[model samples]
Target: MEQSSKKSALSEKDGVNQPQSLSNSSVEVIKQMRRKQPSAQELIDGILAKDKVALSRAITLVESTNPEHLEKANTIIQACLPHANKSIRIGITGVPGVGKSTFIEAFGKHITSLGRKVAVLAVDPSSTISHGSILGDKTRMEELVKDENAFIRPSASGETLGGVARKTRETIILCEACGFDTIIIETVGVGQSETAVHSMVDFFLLLKISGAGDELQGIKRGIMEMADAIVINKADGDNIAKAKLAKTEFNRALHLFPAKQSGWIPTAATCSSYTKEGIDTVWKTISDYFELVKTNHYFEEKRQNQNQFWMMETINEQLKSNFYNHPEIIKLLEENKKAVQNDEISPFAAAINLLGKYFKS
Candidate 1:
């Protein structure tokens, strides 16, 4: 009887443990079901409805390099193109330690308060050694991050010369499609990125600060010429006078540059992100510039030119990728590199040999 009782207790314990194991497995199955991918149409519908989750997912799809994801991303972009071009795209750039995040938070909040949906595509610097990104923009712009009407995405620069992600233009399209009235593309602020940002944006705003050397030294002369407006940030407390002086200097220097194609002169403004002063003036400046450009039809013309530029850029990128990725080229590249270093072969001859092998293969 004692033996039978012990056997019954063991069986009951096994039966109890079986359901617990099954329960744990059932929870995992539920999680997998929750993570199942959404279809393209669903993503489109959700994005059009201004669903932030869907918008983020759509941007991720656009950023993906996977072949299948790229195809789907292209389809999504094609579907969304008709709905885009409604937003005013702005590019904001400045050197490090110029308070770009604080200014953006203030600027973004001010815009959102006026019933405008804002989207920030902040490009973060990727480490050259690890190729990984800090992606800390969201943390820096806490107010904007918490705002219901704002969408902020931080992308790795991936060592692109322009300090922008390769997919920034596509990301802009997706953001516009999601009904954001204001789309801000924040570059990594390494100075070379201004031209790339200017090419895509309707207006380029250069954020500067007083006491940062000559205002021109803070930004390259080429970048200054490209700015639609120069905003001197941190213009509060004792720095107000210095900010005004910087603004004066910037204005005088801008007068020396040739006129813009839009025929509207670039202006300067002073703003204190801490005090939230001059933020509205900055917005008004952008609005007035857009109004003037739209009246002259330059806005449309610029976007058309951007499209052509992107097409050419894509073609060039593809050709380079194909050339460098060829198996024959890869096999010869290392050997030729060593030969060149040792003076066994001229660099020109090595190049020709590689090209010959590539073409034959």
Candidate 2:
């Protein structure tokens, strides 16, 4: 009877030990298994949790064309929608050697000093001949980029026109969603065809050098007329007089142009990026412009329109990509190119035929 009682006790111990072993094994299995992908809410929570690393990764996903990440990116963007629209979007552009980067660093430093966050995006146009971009602008923005409150992203324009990457507009949305509060987009100083940036940004700032007479001569009227504010850079020491003269000329030139969509008049001022002088004046003008537009109730309306514009642009980009990727369309384009080379069809006719064939159901 004692032996039977001892056996019963052993059985009871085994029963409890078996369950404990299984429980430990189950946990080990769970730990070895791949973690389930995070939901959009989870992603946003991670971002709001002040996870800078997560924010950086999320922005990368949004900028990516990876098929696997696109859905996740879209979801994250949706979650971030409500928390967005709290930032000021500024577009800065100038010809080469106009101290664009210097001014930006100075300007960015000034903004962040007020305890606001600034995100600067450099748009480097892709070189047609080499299929590469010389992304040197960010290197010049050393001081601002080092600031804890500043984030800098340099994007390759790739075959996109307008001196900006096609994804730049989308990137702006993501940045604003991240609580940046101030977003600055710097475009490759393409003399003209940069109005695309103007449409997307609240303030369009044009930077000019003091002695760019020949360079400015080549600039088209449309870009000049599109500017909300013109900044004559390099206004230090010997060039101060020339900078002052350029400012006067620009001010006079601006008067001849019509008002912007915001109905705000563009102002021209001189500044020395090297010395950081006149930087405050530039910011003050921007502040004044914001006050004027906000008071007129044009600020909100302008932002709404910009959002709609970007939506249409995004759709068009997707459709274009799809149309080009279709197998039959690709073959048709190749055949059309051969026909054009053989003089069997006119260039215009081939284009029409290819487009019609692709679109025909």
Candidate 3:
């Protein structure tokens, strides 16, 4: 009887241990799901669930280039596709001292006061030497950064160009799904190269300094041609007259460049970001823009174009990654570089030969 009792006790002990082991395994699975980027369905469900943290993580995943995360990011994008078209994307750019940050701070606060949510993503060009970002937007937009209705993300140039972050398109999708109606993309104004932001935004606001007539002489005409609305910042006190003068010059210059896009004529105005003067007018102008374009079917067309642009960009990134991933190609490229340096082959010819070798299989 004693032996039988001992056997029964052992069986019960094993049974108890089994549940604990299974529970630990289950907890691990849940943790892993949390650590990974949520699937497209999970992203949509999380948005519906009002899970802001999950939404943010999903955006990060979409921006990541990790070979493992690509499929997950694509699925998340597809899942959130239905809920993604509910927001307005605004691209704002200006030269370094045009007060883009300060203006956004004032402008963003005003938008939130009307009970609308704002998300500002700054795209600062990465320094080639440091291979890191400057991330200056957070320091500049103090009030917007603190506002509950505002989400300000600093620039992430990250070995990319076009003054916008590589993942900004994906980030915008997630933000829109989370019910953010206003999305602002701030770019480092690198002259004509910054036009990449224009391809993605609903409105392109080019901020210029009042005294830029002198500076404009050196600036290219292509940048001015792309502006939908030009705002002269620092339009107060000593700069008022200069700002007005710039407004005239820009208006005259705009007439010379022809209209950009369909049914769009560039408009110029002046604003004092320090006092928040003319900020409301600026917003009203943008609002009027939506009214003008919505009726003409231009708004929808623009969104479709932007989506196409994102797809192309994603494919290009994938191709670049694949090209660099080939060990033989990399070795051949290094060898070809020395040959070119010794004048054995031209750069163009060397590139073609390497590409042919890479694709020969």
Candidate 4:
């Protein structure tokens, strides 16, 4: 480098040029990585070829809130439609304290051991204040997370199940197209999350632990009716006897619920994620359900109905998003909310006022 020592303050000679921080080729590569999103056809082809990286990227696009990503994600879903619906979608839900992650890992590893590819879509609850989620399913399921035959994706349970469930449903399609034969959706088990998951899955499993006195007392009637199998998890050590008792109680409670349209009688089973005991029984139970449903043709019928439900849900989600995002409505919503909270206006009136302006504008 050369410098001008004898130069006027305002007329200093230009210093010799320094090398670029990055090469032109390196810059081009970085730009391509940042700016070039894979085409829908390219993502579809990659998914069909069972590429995990492509599957993850495609799922990310589906979950993205960006308008452009939404368009591409829809296109990719349409393309993968032909290959989807071939896998059994199972919904597993339990209360917050239940060992859902551990049970899922054990169950998933067992499924993969049987030479089947498994994909887990675990939904973590988001905090109301911060809207941030723990997203720790991958961390919790270390062994299953590392398995070559297993794929785990953790998604945040947003304000509602509408958008997140839709994304999860689409992710299922992508995973199926990528050759995953079994898809498991693990819900955060809050509010209506289980119901949303139940609508999409073929077999619904309600996981439980032996505690809190009567097991039947803790279960919701709707969940019991929806559940194809109620499996009591953590049936290891001193919990074995309690688990068996819970299983018996659950079986009796299951008998009280009316017969299902699928003509399948839900049963209560026990499984130990620690000892791997009765894990196979859970699979056998799931297999038995699929066999019966397929034989009775309820499997295809349910899929058709689920597709219709998905359409309605998508409509609801889009309308909700549009209403909340309206500039005119956005200005008035907080005013109405504060008015309602202060008893200046009834919630119904506030809602009507907001809805009226939203629709009018």
Better of 1 and 3 by lDDT: 1
Relative to the unseen true structure, what is the C-alpha lDDT of residue 1 in candidate 1, on a scale of 0 to 100? 30
Candidate 3 structure lDDT = 0.80
Candidates 2 and 4, the one with greater TM-score: 4
- Whose TM-score is greatest here? 1
Q: Across residues 111-206, which tens digit of lDDT does each residue of candidate 4 receive? A: 999999999999888888998988999999999999999999999877775324458888988999999999999988764787788888999998
In order, what lDDT does every prediction score? 0.90, 0.81, 0.80, 0.89
| Model 4 misplaced regions, further than 4 Å | 1-32, 161-166, 214-216, 332-350
Judged by whole-model lDDT over C-alpha atoms, candidate 2 comes out at 0.81
Q: Clashes in each model (backbone N, CA, C under 3 Å)?
A: 0, 0, 1, 0
Q: Which stretches of candidate 3 lie over 4 Å from their true place?
A: 1-44, 212-215, 218-220
lDDT of 2 at 120: 92
Q: Write the per-residue lDDT of candidate 2 for residues 50-107, one digit (tens) a residue.
A: 4555676777777677877888888877777777788888999988778778899999
lDDT of 1 by residue, 202-241 (tens): 9999899998685759445678888889999999999999
Provide the lowest-lDDT 10-residue window in model 3: 12-21
